[model samples]
Target: MFESLGAFVDHLRAQGKLVDIDEELSPDYEVAAAVRLIDQRLGKAVLCRKVRGCGMPVVANILARRDLLRLAFASPNDPTEEYLRRIGGSLPPEVVRAAPVHEVVHDGDFDVAKLLPLLLHHEKDAARYISSGVTVSRDPQTGLRGMGIYRIQVCGPRELTISIGSPPVSDFLAKANATGKPLPVAIAIGLEPLSYFASVVPVAAGVDKFDAAGTLRGAPVPLVAARTQPVEVYAEAEIVLEGEMLPNTQREDGPVGESTGYYHAGRSWAARLTAVTHRAHPFYYALVPFAAENTLLMGVTREADLLAALRRKFPSVRRVSLTQGSVAMLAIIQAAPASKEEATAMVRAALEGSMQVKTAILVDADVDPHDLNDVQWALSTRFQADRDLLVLRDLPGSPIDPTATNRRTAKLGLDATRPADQAEAFMRIALDPAARRRVEEILARLT
Candidate 1:
């Protein structure tokens, strides 16, 4: 696998996946418009070599494609299951004494507007935002590290308000707020895409996320200490920001766009940018904020985590997939024959793990859960509305949920799994293997 961001870019280029734009596009809308449309439409990685206001080129939509995802995995089998099995539980990262991020530092009286590309995305957006900020922090009590991708809107050259919502990391910061202590954090940008995605995993509270990265890469992630803050960072990252979440500090955070494709309500929270640090030639990653790929990442995380939770109750569960473009609410799971009771239990168990799972699907092993058409066909053929549909009300609506209505949203479950050893009606059929291969070969010649 490619070790660094540049190597990954080279890999993408070799595969003709990266689009390098040399045009002088303005950061206000020109550059952002291309990023938004390319990311939302093509779903491929793009690199803008020139920006109107910023000194650096902005790269977005890198993680938008499954080809990049496959490269990140580098495995033949499905990356989702491969990822889940590889990094379900992991250990600490390898901390280096010093590296590139520490070589350049911004101390007191530093001006961020001169260094980073804090671009304004939308017309109504309040101000510029570091759209790709990957926050790195530690749990105060448990001392466990927390890495997540969240929005940070710029309030000043050095200040931005954060929206962490009610997540585990948020809860940890909440505790820090009660004690009058500011939470130390490191924001890393332009790291490996695997590292970036690992930052967003929903690990056990206080459990490290880098372990997942290490597991995916088959090696420990090299880390370096930040000069301005008491936190460690991935040394390979092009840029790093040292900051602290302020105690009882509040500012109007949102009205900036989110992954939900809507400018939801804004809240106030205090986030202090103590110092900005980066390499001599840093490549900044700017995401088209509301892209479906981001939503898919979140949905996949919830699905994998749900599979882990359901395995304890229904070990027969073999495969699962959360549907794309759900706003992160629905899922489909494929399992071998267990009991009918076990199928129902698996659905309920998944909901408990991810409250955002508004729809859970339990399908027999023959069904390809990842393919939406096949799963929907199963629903249409085997299911009737009143009998097959299962709904749960008053469940916690996850933060990204727009129709949350105060986190009270309805959930649905489909028991599409077949009865054990009962192949009479549920048996899957297909043409003979050799005969199908011959047909495909003939079709290939003609087409």
Candidate 2:
């Protein structure tokens, strides 16, 4: 397990998965443009050594691909299985006396925009955003800790607006607001992969994400108390912003591009920044909203959980794929269904299990769920819309879904598995093994 984000970055550099840019770049659009170009060409994480105005360097696209996710866990095998194994248990975090985050603390005379390299990713973005800050909070009554990735809008030097959506953190803020008290919050930037993964997973209310993160790392995560808040943050985090979500207060927050590839109008609630602390010469992490890294970061853990949830109900479920291009709205399942009834049941289970999954397609175990072409082939040959289509209307849906009306939308499922009686008719054409081997040998010599 990595001790800090710096360690993870170093590991990525050693593996040739990261690139360093010595050229100066502006935080507004230049840094984001460079990241997008590199993501399209090389798909490597970038570390910009100099920014136009900021003192700290900026890093982007840290988890842009599945291979990088595997590398984060130091696992060369299946990433899903590795992720499942890591988060299967829980371990409480350990508190430490000192932390790198508190090495340089600024309680007064601080300007967030001037100090940090916040990025303006899209052309229509209202302002620079903190897209990757893992906001941490706790229940005032039960003292249950919650962590989540929230969009923080830079409104002023000490004031910011936050998007508190459907997550545990929102609930915590609500409970605190009921008491007419500002909810204490700590935003940790540049965290290790395990901590970041745990923050995004859907867990029960009152569940501590730090414990979950410790479990994923196979060791207890070290925590240090924030300088300006009661909340504790990852001791090794590169930067930590301590603040409070003001009660009965709201402001314009966005029109910023989200992971769903659309601009969401700004929310009302705002956070009052109290202190900004960081390690000396910290790395400013930037996550370009609607990018590959944004999709994978949100979808990978959800896919693993969905796979486990489906297998518990249907043993025949071999694999589950939350298609990256669909932004996690589409799910493809590879399973061996005994009959049409069983295939339909599996589809229903998948839809019921994951609220974000709007489209589900069930294929035979022979078809690769991860391969879009193979899934499409199954849909073409085995699926009959009249007999296999399952549609649910007027259901609660994701707010990001453009088709959703009044927060409700329709769900579609297709059973693409071949009929049991017509197995021979749907058999796939195969290449002779001896002839394929001979061809491979000839090609190898030619190369």
lDDT of 1 at 438: 98
Every candidate's CA RMSD: 3.2, 2.3
Q: Give the TM-score comparing model 2 with the true structure, all chains together.
A: 0.93
TM-score per prediction, in order, is: 0.87, 0.93
Candidate 1 deviant stretches above 4 angstroms: 108-110, 139-144, 166-172, 336-353, 416-447
lDDT of each: 0.75, 0.86
- Tens-place lDDT per residue, model 1, 1-447, is 556677777788888788889999877767678887877667678888987777777777767755567777776667677677677656558998877666578878776776776677877788777777788877788777777777878787678787776455687788899898999888888887778777777676555778766776777888987777777888888888888989878887767776777775567676778887777777788876776567656665676777877776778888777776676577787877466666777777776667778788878777888788888877876665665567787888676677778877777788876556676777677899999999999999999
- Candidate 2's C-alpha runs over 4 A off are 430-447
Worst lDDT run of 10 residues, candidate 1, spans: 292-301
* Residue range with the least summed lDDT across 10 consecutive positions in model 2: 197-206
Q: Pick the candidate with the highest lDDT.
A: 2
